[model samples]
Target chain A: MKTLLNKDQLNITLQRLAHQLVENHLSFKDTAIIGIQPRGIYLSDRIAHMVRNITGQKRIDYGRLDITFYRDDVQSRDIQVPSDTDIAFSIENKSVILIDDVLHTGRTIRSAMDALIDYGRPKNVELLVLVDRRFSRELPIQPDYVGHTVDTILTQKVKVYWKEKDGKDEVVLIDKV
Target chain B: MPLSVKHLLGIKELTVQDIEQIFQTADEFKQVLQRPIKKVPTLRDTTVANIFFENSTRTRLSFELAEKRLGADVVNFSASGSSVSKGETLIDTVNNILAMKVDMVVMRHSASGAPWFLANHIDASIVNAGDGINEHPTQALLDSFSIRERLGSLKGKRIAIIGDIMHSRVALSNIYCLAKLGAEVTVSGPPTLIPKHIESLGVRVEYNVKKALEWCDVANVLRIQLERQHKPLFSTLREYALFYGINKQMLDGLKKKIIIMHPGPINRGVEINSDVADSGQSIILNQVENGVAIRMAVIYLLSGKKDAQLSI
Candidate 1:
């Protein structure tokens, strides 16, 4: 296993990503940050928290989205316990930042997009990922703001850990068993 | 988490973990219902058949709506005008339905153990809507869910199943479900309506309605099954209501506010007065609302089971 980002590096990368978001969305008036549920929530929470702190905006449009029900292979795949979704603010005519930890197959983004439009049609949507696993695009998806990009094969995996859940903030790459 | 059990036939067979799983899933489903577009496509490729041998309005509609919300193609069958009136057998009827690629069956039958009988002979999953005064699992589930919504938990809670326990599948199912979840239960009514030796089921029996209402944290008044009365169990509805029916006065007399619930098709003044049924304390409508989610949880959790077996 390789340590892609240690604790200090992860914090630095998060600040960079947060700055990138603040740079694009000044005042965040027409921008919304949505974190995909389960693991994406950690990345979204960190990025959203940092963006709010950097911009000093208390009422920033932030939400959590669960795409378990919107998956294309819901039946054929292993059953996953669904997480809660709480998108209170209006996404209508707003640019939504769809955040996730890792961008691999891009199916999660597809399902997240399908689930997001149900709330309301956003003006546009942007992708953000902490680790961009290049050459692993099952769908035509790319990240607008990437913290790090790694060349990985199908059998390898990228794991992101956060202090809130894993008791430490670190990114690691694991080889196949 | 996936449910340990495949089909929700009755609460009697369900473990506390299963009930907890269903309730936890239904919590998310409730959120789903509050959305602008209240539907999901999890079961888009699945088909479910709701076969009701007995008459129903709410349960049938609730199951249909739940199936639709889950994106399952629902085919409803009622025995009133169907070929069952033309001397067809139960297995024959179900087999015919199954032959057409039906994946799941939700049935309400007049005979006890009908779902069990059908489950033994069928390839598809079976959900017992209600089986002849034996158990109505989903109703009990929704009832407990409503109680949990109001009080936070069913553990150590005092729940009273008031009125006709003899003929109520809701009563029996509620007793089992509540007991399994660590709640104290009491069945209160006249001797005839309250069956003998029901204490064997681990619930207290109270002959007086006032005492039952006074001692309990929640009162789940059950409808006196007038249609199921083979012989006159009580002299008349008036006498039964006078002594046993839940009214506004009884609720007003309680020292503390207790959650009022009823699995509906409520007898206006027979088992519960209109004032109490429509009162703010009553979660009768919430029970109706939660039915869809609970049924959806059951259907979604079970839909994947048969396919898992079929693949092997």
Candidate 2:
């Protein structure tokens, strides 16, 4: 296992991502932040919190979306209990930011895109990820904002741990045997 | 996560955890239904056959809609105007369908334990739509879901199952599901319509519908199935309505507001009056709406039991 980002480095990365978001979505009017459910929630929650502080906004249109039903591998994989998809606000004609912890094969992003169609049509969607596993994407999905980019083999797994959920904040690459 | 059993034959065979798991999953599907593009692609590769040996409208259509919403390939079969009338055996008919690469079967039959027998013989997962006075597991699930959605939780909730308990697959299923969820259930109807020794199922028996309505938080009134009754259990439909039918007057008489629910095809003035059925406290329509979500949850979980995986 190789540690990619330590405690202090992870904190700095989060702040940088938040600033980048505020810089692009100044005043945050028609833009909505959506965290892909389960893992993406950890990263988006922290980023959304930091953006709220930086922009001095009380609350932004942020929601969590679960793409389990939209996944293509339902027949093949073990069906796990789905996380809550709490998109309480409308995303119609709004610039949406889809956030996640890591971008692997891009299948999840594909599923999330399909899942998002049910909600009102967004003006546009941009992908944001903490770690982008370069050269591993099966779909042509590219991330707009990336904290770190890593080149990894097929068997290696990228895992991001949060302080709230995993007792610490860090990123690690595990070589699956 | 995987459901404990391969086939959902009856609620009696499900543990409380399994029921809870299904409920939790159904909660997610409920949100999916709210979306403008309500269809999900999870079951695209899986084909389901909805075989109804018995006639139905709501339950059958509910299952079909659930299957369609989940992106499943659905094949519908009915006994009437089918090969069943041509003296085809149950196993032979099902095996023929399975031969067409069907992965699951949703069935409703006139014989009790029909789904159980099918589950034992077939490899495909069998969901019991309703089997002759046995257990309509999904109906009970959606009913409980509707109650929980309205009243928050089922634990310690007083739910009175009123009317035609002896002939209702729904009442039996509801009793098992509610009891497992720490809910107190009561079977209330005319003594003749309710089965003997039903109290052994850990439910109270009330002969008076008014008394049951006065006692419970929710009254899950069941329809008096005239077709299922071989002989007249009660004197007359008018007399039955006068004594047992739930109406606006009963709610006004009750000290507390009691939720009213029915599975479907309500006998209108017989089991429940039109006024009460259309009342503010009635969650009968919500039960129908939740049926698709509950079914989608069950089918998705059971589909996970397959050992197949994409070669990634």
Candidate 3:
């Protein structure tokens, strides 16, 4: 296992991502920040809080989106427990930023895009990732904001950890045993 | 924990954890139902068949809508106008449908254990909508879901299932579900309507409606099911109404607020009065609304997709 990001490095990267969000989406009037469920939710929470603090916005629209039902491999799995999709507000005409922890094959983002349309058509949509695994794209998808880019073989896995959840802040690359 | 069984044939075959997991999944689907677009794409690659060997309106339509909302292609097969009228066997009928590439079967038959039998023979997933007086797993699930939604939990809650107990799949399934979830269950009706050896199921049998109502936090009143009655079990409808029917006057005389519930196609004045059925304490309509979500959850879970990590 290789430690790709330590605590301080992860904090700086998140701060940079937060700043980029505020700079790109000024005032965030028609913007909606959606965190992909499970892992992406933690990253989205961190970024949404930081963006709100930096922009001094009282109530920025934030929601959690689960794409379990919209996945391409529904027939191939053993068990599927769907997560909560708590998007109370309309995403119609809003600039949507989809946040995920790591972007690998890009299939999850594709499913998220398909799931988002059922709620409403967004004015625009962008992807943000904490880590982007390069040269492993299965779909025509790329991240607009990336914290780190790592190159690896097909057998490797990138594991992300958070202080609130995993009792630490780090990203690790584990080789297939 | 997730539902380990491939088919939802009966509540008797389910554990408390399985019931709770279905409710948890149904909770998420209920949120999806509240959205502007009340559909998910989880079962897009799948196909479900609604094979009703008996006549139905609510159960058939609920299963169809649930399948559609989950983006599954559905085929409705009724025995009335189909080859089953020509003496086709249940296995032959389902096998033919399976040959058409159906992935799941939601069946309601006049005979008990039809879905269970089909599950044993067929490769496709099976969900028993209602099999004679055997079980209606989804109805029990949605009923539990509604109870949990209103009362917060099923543990230690006193629930009385009133009216026809012998011919009601709802009562049997509810009894199994409530008992498994640790709810105090009581069945009240005429002695003939209450099944023999029902006390063996760990439920108290009450002959008087007032006594049952006085002891319960919720009363699930079932329709008399005149179609299923082979002989007149009571003197008349009026006599049954006088003895067991639920009315506003009877409820008001109790001097306490108790939840009222009825499985639909209500007999108006036979089992539950219109005044009480339409009253504030009645959750009949909410049960119907939760039916779609509950069925969607069942279908989605049994469709064999990988489980997503649940935050809650």
For each candidate, report its DockQ versus the true two-chain complex: 0.63, 0.78, 0.63
Q: Any runs in candidate 3 off by more than 4 Å, and if so which? A: B305-312
| Interface RMSD, every prediction, one decimal place | 1.7, 1.4, 2.0
lDDT of each: 0.91, 0.91, 0.90
TM-score ranking from best candidate downward: 1, 2, 3
List the candidate 1 regions with Cα displacement exceeding 4 Å: B305-312
Q: Candidate 3 i-RMS (Å)? A: 2.0
TM-score for all models, in order of appearance = 0.97, 0.97, 0.96
Candidate 2 residue-wise lDDT, A1-177, digit = tens: 999999999999989999999999998898999999989999999999999999999779999999988888876667888889999899999999999999999999999998887898999998899999999999999999999999999999999999999999899999999
Model 2 chain A: lowest-lDDT 10 consecutive positions: A72-81
lDDT-sorted candidate list, best first: 2, 1, 3
TM-score, chain A, per candidate?
Answer: 0.98, 0.98, 0.98
Better of 1 and 3 by DockQ: 1
List the candidate 2 regions with Cα displacement exceeding 4 Å: B305-312
